[model samples]
Target: MTAASRPKSVYPLGAKAVRILVADDHLVYRIGIRNLLGSEPGFDVVGEAADGLQAVELYRKLRPDVLLLDLRMPHKNGVEVVRAIRQEHQTARILVVTSYQTEEEVFQVLQAGAQGYVVKDVGRETLIEAIRAVNAGTRWVPPAIQKQFSDRVLRQELTAREIEVLRLLTRGLTNREIANVYGISANTVKNHLNNLMAKLDVADRTEAVSFCLARGIVKPEEI
Candidate 1:
């Protein structure tokens, strides 16, 4: 049998299974996730959706315990689907599972009502943990992302220039481009970035952006 024909296992255990719906445009990836999740002891793969629209439809129809959403898809994207679901079901428990790990994207999903966010590159163990945490009325943002959120809430020591630099960073602009945009020297941009990182208590640009979004310093739609 070919890889495509491999069997997909479903786990049936005594624990109250967390019903799940997987949404992604890629057929193989969706199926792979179903197989992986199905093999877990307390997860039920209730449905699969190939796009955001379909995901929303399935969410309404199945009301699964968790909605595993992919950020990019044909005919609406994850953000749209999340909004649609939340509008109809205020108590929705959505988890964004996507390939893009940028702070801007992560922040947008959470603001849209996602209980947790996990990057596609995350290990299977971390992925499972995130799902469990979200299902248990808890949250699971990366530590770096969490720090950004916390700093933003307290309006910590970030200076005006640092905020500008951080906002530009969320836009995914290069250091040189940011400098040009602000009429500053490249070295000056680097210095601002260093200070921003220090003030945010983060070690890198990604974390800073995530922090900014988590704290509402930068709106996701603006990115």
Candidate 2:
């Protein structure tokens, strides 16, 4: 069913139902999630949002007990949405359900105050468990995701300037062009590149860009 035609609230058949707001860019995914959650005993799928902005807006209106958010949405990405919602409602329970599994994506959303992160391909039971866990004020990160996140935490982090340089590198900018963009010398740009490459554990600029792209640290559209 279309989001517009779907029931605004599914009455709970059990005591103390968990109200949920589903947000994703894809209509099919939203419908699928709504159906899946609606089948559970204590779930009340209260609303649906088709994009990040709508997600934020709906959260304000519905105030669901749990929000199932997708990481990549128009108007605002998951990180931005989490930060926006948490800024207004510190106790908001958000669970990121997305296909993106890159360490950077997971870390960014969690840092922005998401209570849980689960890949889209997780089993139905796991997804339901995560929602329930987050609703009960617990942080949920699957074992594999937690391990990758831990590994990323142990590695050296890239400085803001270094990350900026990396983005420019992905755009195929030359050292001179990048330096000019930042009002720095070519030598300074080279220094940033070298530092970023070291932190990323890549051999050269090309490898650094490739690594960032592969790891979802720098998205192609952002370039």
- Candidate number of the best lDDT: 2
**lDDT tens digits by residue: candidate 1, 1-223:** 4334544334455668898999999898888888777666688889999988999999989999888889999998888898899999988888888888666666667778888887788876688888888888788888876755554444546777777787789889999999999899999999999987787688889988887787777778866
Global fold similarity of model 1 (TM-score): 0.64
Error in Å for residue 194 of model 2: 26
Q: Look at candidate 2 and tell me the lDDT of residue 10.
A: 38
lDDT of 2 by residue, 164-212 (tens): 8989998899999999999999999998888877777789999988877
Question: What ranges in model 2 sit over 4 Å off?
Answer: 1-14, 156-223
> How many residue pairs clash in model 2?
0
RMSD of 1: 9.4
Question: How many residue pairs clash per model?
Answer: 1, 0
Q: Considering only N, C-alpha and C atoms within 3 Å, which residue pairs clash in candidate 1?
A: 148-211
Query: Scored by CA lDDT, what does every candidate get?
Result: 0.82, 0.88
